[model samples]
Target: MGLLSKSRKASGDVIYNNEVKPQLVAKDGNIHIVMINSFSKLVNQNFGVESKYTEQIGSVINDLQQDGYEIVDIKFDSLKGQGITGTAEGFHTLIMYK
Candidate 1:
């Protein structure tokens, strides 16, 4: 079975692009591009020192750029929840796409 199949069987929530909706469109050079419509739900959550996390994500993107990876976009998601949600809930997710 493929990794996606296994993940689905395990009831895992997968993150595929920012948009949940899936669509395809032809781009220049006849290249097909898949688009996922999604909003930054993480931004809705409360995170102490939000700017700090944003800066951290920016730094990461900068590093990646320096490494020669063309950053298409950077999405910062503020993990929500409290002590029960784990420390990760307080962290931000830096989604980088080349």
Candidate 2:
């Protein structure tokens, strides 16, 4: 079984526990591009210092850059929650290439 399959069978969470953190998944050290998409819910829960979604994304990007990763692209999407039952949310996507 592949890493993804093993991860899925182990837990439902894909990004958090399944995928390797702090390292790019490369095949023979040939992976030159990496993409990261983070939701407000996950980011806020993970990073205790950041109180806002943008702040969380910024913190992550800063860390990655400091670690010698180059930012290739970035995108942000704002989500307006529905009715009174939904909470506002946002998505931050970062593309890094080494």
Candidate 3:
């Protein structure tokens, strides 16, 4: 088996706990964190349940702020239709530090 045989993709919480937390503990300076999520995959889906990417992102921001991180910037953008034939896709990004 490989070193990652039992490992999986880390969730936001995992990243915060294992990576961010350690850095914060070892350093007294500000720590920068950037998170990005795309909604294009769900844009034209027929799933009955509403997607909560936006809400989840907000929750992460709130949690980070509560943990002492300051919001540095926020950006939202959409990819315009390609060649005037493709549908536009949206994305959200957040930059925080400390």
lDDT of 2 by residue, 57-85 (tens): 45555555665666666655555452244
- Pairs that collide, model 1: 18-38, 19-36, 19-37, 19-38, 20-37
Ranking by lDDT: 3, 2, 1
Show the lowest summed lDDT stretch of 10 residues, model 1: 12-21
Q: How do the predictions measure up, each by TM-score?
A: 0.36, 0.45, 0.45
lDDT of 1 by residue, 11-93 (tens): 21222322311332322334232222222223444746544333434444454455444545444443445344343345444
Regions of model 2 farther than 4 Å from truth: 1-20, 26-51, 82-85
Question: What's the residue-level lDDT of 62 in candidate 2?
Answer: 59
Instruction: List lDDT for all candidates, in order.
Output: 0.38, 0.46, 0.52
Error of 3 at 24 (Å): 7.3
User: What's the distance in Å from true for residue 75, model 3?
Assistant: 2.3
In Å, residue 25's CA in model 3 sits off its true spot by: 9.0
What TM-score does prediction 3 earn?
0.45
